[model samples]
Target: MGHEYAFDWLDQMVHELDPQRTEPERLDNYQSIAIVEKAASEKKRLILLFKQFVFREQKTRQIRNSVNHYLSAAVSLMKIANNNLNQIPTKANNFRLALESVFSCLSEVSAFIVNRYRSHVDRDISLNLVNITPDAHDLRTLGNRDAMKSNLKLSKLVTEAFSDIFSDHRGGEITMRKLDYWVSVSHAVTYPNGLLEMTTPFEQLELIMIERNFNSPLFVKYLVSKFSEGIANSEDPSSRVQALTFLQKTFNQIPVMKDIIFNNQFEDLTLTINSWFIQEINFHSERSGTVFSDLGEQTQKASKKYERKTSDKVLCNLTVDQLSIFFKAADLSNIISARSLSAIFQSVAPYLSTPHRTDISHSSLRVKSYSVEERDKSLLIDIMTRLTEQIRDL
Candidate 1:
């Protein structure tokens, strides 16, 4: 609506270009050709501005103009095609293709805006994010949960708009460090050396960077600090699971203090985890949640209704030889002579499958070893019984 002259020109231009609105010779009409050429020239300039906007440049006015330009171009092109993309004639096939290219570009830009942009405005009034200042409290509380409604209503306008733009194309070659990129983007949006320049709180900036790159060392140290702080504030057990799982998986990935921090500190780590969680035991502690001291047997049951099929998450850790032994035992109606188990397996080896029959050995003094967990409570308890002795020997 602000670009009334542009809008009026577009409506008149599209109307004149419509074959139904003019004579059969409309394609050859000098005036029609001139209008199309003028639109083409204007579209070219708008495209340059649109590209800059997509690249996270803060050309607000030009972006608005280009957005309107796309709208105008799309409407006119559809009218010329009579809503048929495939039936576009050779007389103006070039124009049709150009319109399609612009529309496709606009789709990606619009999708980026939808997926990321949080408008920093109220009642269509600009908040000018760089000028608004936050105190220590805001920085401390950032990302603890969702952003405050009013702050999100008008905060980090530039960051929000362009964060996805950075994330969406992160696979491309990057000339700067990941943290450097965010800092540069902040400068690009909020501190362009004119108007009002301000800085994002270092704490908030670090939090944002951590969220973007979850495997960052800063995040790992922050988690280690939070979990080791002698208390857990949140009631969510997933936090505990996440912290412990990530630490266990990426212990060596944390750079300088891997061995000093985690190699011989299992006792301390377990104690810290217990301090935070032993009493609470997750939200299942609430009476409203279901509890079954014993679910008894999991009897096989058929599906009663339509449900999405999901892959079974069961983890198989047994060797093929063990499975073959189990199969033989099952086939023998669960009869097992401890002395003859290995001999029986060796005898049956030739009749079994290739991998399954590879080897069989009897061990009277077998050492139990479990290096991976398969989400079994009883199995975990059995493994825990051995962990202390194993660590003591280490």
Candidate 2:
């Protein structure tokens, strides 16, 4: 197919020249102008053909090959036109038109190709279709619901087909690259709806929590309890793990909720503890505590004195080991009811065995600089051993 297009282009160029003429200069200039014009026109025609095929319902492979062939020919013609411009030294409108045509053709072809491919790529390919149909009783009462089901089913099939096609690359190698393109396209198409759907899950979860009239601590407890039940009932290990992780994350959000309620005084403390614990457990720091600082700063006018005092104490007094206590406490018991201040103290005992460095030199009161270093390590180990023993007994 490409070969045929290239041959046609070459034939057009050959027929554009004059072989016999008396005036050598006139003939030479005329031949150069004719060739430039012919190449330009051919390039323009190819561009038009590409546009038509791309827009029309036709075989993807055939359209792709034809477009590629025309594009190649157009590029070659552009080079020839440029070369002829220097050789002829004439202000021929044909060469200019040809060059402009090449530019226009390439622009249109590139845009059309990119847009067509991009239209299909989207993240919603992974999302399941949510049917929005009303109940059968309501539909029967309304008397206008049958069409709605048909439309919804059609939408589901289309979305599923698109996902399956992109997943498997049924269209061959070309479609593989088009997957990324379609991803972008899908993002654009479904972004608005995605944002709406996002609110729904959180809202549903919140509504369930709100019905209990629970504070942050109690809310977290409820979530953990429900999550544990969900995990126990779940047969799939992956689902269980996901549910557990989600519950832990939900519990972790308690400190943030508390900060919001208390006007952000101890937010930094919460974040700092979270960061250190994540680093210890996951071997990676999640993110910095800057957001806590930002929240404090935002509410500084109203809570300046409170914020200053709490920030100073949290930032200066708390050690990494102390923070680890909070994290361990967060995971003490499977049932939320089993977790209390006592449980927190119990969780902290193990970490306390590995006492952090304590320097009293900076204390406001002029206290004796006694070295507790001798007992710190041994004391920490003893506490940890006791905690372990207690946990085993339980």
Candidate 3:
């Protein structure tokens, strides 16, 4: 089965690489013959083919393994194509196009692997890539002059291809070393400066946090450290400014992050950065009272029937004591009507059978409130589990 997949990919690549099938004239625009479109239609088609192969192989294999297969197959195909260079027509650039297409496939596959499996990548796999392409040859190989020039041109295309992917930070689970590898091998391609030199790791870290809605505790820790490093290392005012912007945006949008950042443990950080967060925390604290008021307004605008039904459904199974515990914990005693709350309890557990009262009063419910015991905690947990299960079933 593996051999069959190999044969299929090879056959398809050979057909695409055929010099006789090359149509350089097809690159001409109909509106004007004077300008030849720079679009590498053949290269795009080859990339699309490689993408299809990746997706097809994923059904039978793990995604990482499939990408490995793509790398192996792409290398083999390029070497085979290189050996057959003599077959090309004298004046045609089809051979160059074929080589560019394979390199582009390598670039695409490398970027995809880094994006999807940053944490799981087998670093040893890159060793297989040595000597697989003309670019891998040392410059001292004076006999391979044409191949060297081709390598230079293809390297630029690969680098240019990286521009779009790198423009916005790509997010995934990654270690610091692995991230450096990715920046070097994927983003930089031919020449790789580590993530620290060209850009701040904080932006990509921000992306990872954003993916989880900024709830990641570990990444929050990383964010603090990276911001410190970025501020210290960055000589450019614009870069530091950008990092500060990201920091402010993150704290402003995520309340939990604000708490984490303002915790007493982070005092080891520079006083300047610490003071910035302190000002933000103080400013937010000033407006914190409006949060509940805003929620109340939104809740009022929401369907009253839905709110009543949700409140009733959640409160129905609880004992009077449990209801009292919940109301206090949730601080819903003043927000929710005492009469409505009492009626819901009475309706579910009959007034005579349960500890519920015939008349509605906050004082009656408040009198039932007690310090939550083990059984009461267990009961609340069970109720929460059942409600979540119901929601899931829906």
Model 3 steric clash total:
0
lDDT of each structure?
Answer: 0.35, 0.36, 0.41
Cα distance off (Å), candidate 2, residue 138: 43
What lDDT tens digits, residue by residue, belong to model 2 across residues 1-394? 3344433644344323212212224444455455556556655665455456556636765564454444444444434534443443254444444434443434444444444443322211221111111122121232233222334432343243344443443423222232333343233233322332233223332322222222334333443444456557756544444444454455444322110121111123233333323322222112221223433343344233222232223223334443333333333222232222232333233222222333211121111111223354465567668879999999
* 246: Cα error in model 1, Å: 20
What TM-score does structure 3 among the candidates reach?
0.23
Model 2 quality (TM-score)? 0.25
- Which stretches in model 3 have alpha-carbon errors above 4 Å? 1-11, 14-61, 82-90, 127-394
The residue-level lDDT of candidate 3 at 326 comes to: 66
Models, CA RMSD each: 25.0, 24.7, 22.7
Which 10 successive residues of model 3 have the least lDDT summed? Answer: 257-266
- Residue 13 error for model 3, in Å? 3.0
For each candidate, give its TM-score against the true structure: 0.23, 0.25, 0.23
TM-score of 1: 0.23
Winner of 2 and 3 under lDDT: 3
In model 2, which regions exceed 4 Å deviation?
Answer: 1-3, 6-40, 47-191, 194-281, 284-394
182-294: candidate 3 lDDT, tens digit per residue: 33333222332243232333233233223223222343454456556655665654455445555655544421212111112112122333345444333443444323354
lDDT winner, 1 or 2 = 2
